[model samples]
Target chain A: MGQKGSKVQITENDRAILQLKRSRDEIHKFTRRTDLLISSERLKLKEMIKENPTKCKSDPRVRFLLKRIHYQDHLLQQALEQLINLENLVSTLEFKLVETQFIKGLERGNQILKKLNKEFENVDELMDDVQMQIAYQEEVDEVLAHSIVGVNDFETEIDKELDQMEREINPQQQIEMPSVDKLPDLKQRPIASSERKEQGKKEGTEAPVLA
Target chain B: MSNQSELPPIYSFPPLYTRQPNGLIRRQQINSWIEIILQYCISQKCWRMTAEGMPVGEPDVTKQSIFNNSSIQRVVPQVFVDEIWSQMCEEGKALGVQDGKRDSSQFYILWRNLDSWASLILQWFESSGSLNQVITIYELSQGDGTADWEFHGMPEALVAHCLKPLCQRNRATLIKDERGIAVATKVV
Candidate 1:
């Protein structure tokens, strides 16, 4: 349900209305697919938790292969800006510029705008980054939450795929994840466990927008 | 990295899901909306969306699952229609959205951006070589055998809006139809 409370009446030049309708529609599709992706990612993370019990080392494949390493948010913001800029450009065209040779310039600019618009056509790539981050984070959180019952499955091969996905969001870097059973020996397992729990909570919220 | 504020104002608007207001912009928005569907609807291509929720007054089923009372309490609550409409409207995209319906005059631009569309029309005009020839405004509006070009489905008001510029260069003229519709003749 939308804001049924407000008596706000949406009225404007027909074309502007059309543009809003359109962007929403496209975004709706984007969000819809995003929902499905996030769902599957949730399933994967849940399964990993169920399979692993004690702090045996998470499958490097699982931990390192997570999506959403970094810059994906940048792209979403970019694409969104691109469309908005296009919208503003169009609105300005409607409002200003009466015939001149400049129409040709406008035409050329239109091509650029069109090309930018095209980038939005397939936004699933953006979703992939967001989902990966969430999925990996979920696994991390769940692992920390349960406090080691046994084998945590993290695979390095899957890490390869995740590396590609993460590259789009963040730079590709090889990270070493100790086996679930191999907790870092910096301190006692129990003390380290408590500290990790705190760290996990902090990282959970700070998930960077991959762009 | 783009500042979140630097992005289109559409981002913050909660009611982007609401419908449009009037004129050429509205229809263009609708056509764009139609275009946007090509990406989603992988299953059977759900092209025609009415903005009304799924049949039985439920929100998108997936959204329903995610928004629980705890999450609802944490973040501000937004209903599907209201949120979509409000976001777009607040960001200045919405117009004429009412209780359960959007104004027929209002449309969402989903697919091609309007400026590109203007260029598209201009290109069609150039390619067709009918620039100077008289064209009943109706041909450009939604009618029989139209929609051949992206320009089809354009509102007469929008056609006139575009022509206003063309006419300044003496490249086009907007005369009257017997029925009071605009008849434009763009000179190549």
Candidate 2:
């Protein structure tokens, strides 16, 4: 009783549970109606007495209504107690249903786990194969490494050549070299611009000797 | 009735009793009436009112009824009362009780709308941990369980009205009796 493709299965137990709940609801509705009737009847009786105290007190219908109200009150109380019990039963049944489903789910899970475990029974052997392959790879790596002599030397030579080429391509390297030696001299002298230019001309002529 | 003294000062004003001629002033006047009606109902805890501007349960026209300002010797005319009710209905602050009737004799004074009332009921259910529990409508409104609640003592019809939104949204289910009266509801 669901969508076109998805039909919900309603078993006898489900129908029983539904019947129980429906009875419980009926009991609840009965108690509520009884409560309303009792109160309203009481109010009517009170109003009747107020309107005509002597005649109402003597009225047989009033007595009958009072008796009926009392009987309904008793019935209401019994129904309420029954409702409580029914509700408890329904909740317990629902909880048991949930627990049953849960246990069934766990059983399914257990079966799947057992099947998976069976499939993985040779896990240790597989691990041994992997370990053997890893060892073989390590041995091959070591043999290759031993056969690769002069590779480090060639790499170092290439690095040295790269450094030299980088220095040759970068004009900032030449400027930085002289600046390191000239910084102390300039800091010590603090030469003015004009005197610094004259000193620079003299230094340019004496640059070869200093080098 | 005892809270009559707590009514606003405008209740005693004579002009409020008369429908103003000017459209803007008349609109404002109707608005003032709406506010007064809402405030007076809240203060008196009155839920339903007749078109004549008298609370439903009170049998006779009492001096304390909002329509009649006894001290001022003025009563709101029927036309003005109808106007106010229409405005209140438009604003979702009141509901006509009779089906297929434009000017129903009685209407619910919804100082709070049904949606808000639905939320309030839901909040109460959550706070009381009554979710998935069956509770009689009578108990929800008048039983000791809801003795201290704001909606306590609310009429059963109003309670049912408030639950409509919840029922539509699948938040609750209303169980009816053989007579097709909703006697209980289960909120989930």
Candidate 3:
């Protein structure tokens, strides 16, 4: 008999919860529809009043219109209040439901701890694997360091060769005079005959020896 | 006049109420104002405007003047308004008072010139078989059949002026009673 009574109590609680959910949905829909209607109507009324304030106020219907707006606002406020209360009721009910789930969760706490310990063991194995990979990376780094030092020495040798080449090129550039025959035709035309004769003799003496 | 809602969006612009200082901008502003006035007059069937480009009242609609954008609290100066009127006169879009009056504050806005209005009246007469049928000047201007006509409510003097072109063309006969009142006309 007590079991039957408890079953009835549970069903009553579920029915109350269902009623609350339905009321909440109704309130939500009502609020949405009313909000849209109220805002648009408010805008239109405001514009009408603004367009002709005296006329709007003097009209006998304005009082009734204002009253209707006030009533709508009151309804909206009441609906919002009901909505909040229903939401609170639902949250409290959910928390009460979670309380039982929490107690059930405690029953399996030791098994959860055992699973966590197994996960820690896996983490230790992963750590060891990571250490092995790190040691391999250190060996690779040492080989790379040795190769890099060799490459650095090779680079210095090439730089030294380039320096010697530049030194040889500088003196040869100083000794080398552009040949009159190879000079542009515009430059040759501007030269006097005496200067050309001097240039020819200098070229004949220096050119064959350099060759 | 018809409702003021037919005004262009720029009609509410405050700058249009002030004549631009630059010559080219002023000219363009004048042209825009002229276009607005022409459109407004034509749409409302307004025949006359004050020098300030406001519609002359037959049956008044509103106190709001076209030259003033009251919402913006700006008004085109009367001098500038008169300049626009003179330009309209130059374009033959408006007729000035003829008697060299000092205060010629009123102008007739001619959406169609007096001659065209005259021809239209003549055509109405022809189509309606009222040709050679003498009718009082009042009947011609405000008769039942002419209610839907554009020349309806036209001043008797202006109607006579319009009919002068028709008379010269021998399409109309002006009849004056013994009292020198132009009592009626017969379109031939």
Winner by DockQ: 2
Estimate the TM-score of every prediction. Answer: 0.25, 0.55, 0.43
Candidate 1 chain B: 10-residue stretch with minimal lDDT? B63-72
How does model 2 fare in lDDT? 0.80
Model 2, runs deviating above 4 Å: A1-73, A97-211, B1-6, B57-73, B98-102, B130-147, B153-188
Candidate 2 lDDT by residue in tens digits, A20-57? 76687578678878998899999988887788888987
Instruction: Compose the digit string of candidate 3's lDDT tens values, residues A1-211.
Output: 1122211112344445555655676687688778877887778778878878878978666666677788888999999999889879876886776687798898799789998888787787799999999999999999999999999999999999999999987755556767888666774565777799899999999989989
lDDT of model 2 at position A112: 97
Q: Which candidate should be chosen as best, given lDDT against the real structure? A: 2
Candidate 2, residue A5: Cα displacement in angstroms equals 20
Which regions of candidate 1 are displaced past 4 Å? Answer: A1-211, B1-83, B86-105, B108-110, B141-148, B153-171, B176-188
Q: Which tens-of-lDDT digit does each residue in B119-145 have in candidate 3? A: 898888987776644545656775556
- Candidate 3, superposed: residue stretches over 4 Å from native: A1-211, B1-3, B97-103, B176-181
Q: Which ten residues in a row have the lowest lDDT in candidate 1 chain A?
A: A1-10
Residues A17-134 of candidate 1: C-alpha lDDT, one tens digit per residue: 3444346435534544555555666567567656885532557745542443213344445555665665576446444533433787899999999999999876888899889999
Give the B-chain TM-score of model 1. 0.41
What is the i-RMS of every prediction? 17.9, 8.1, 47.8
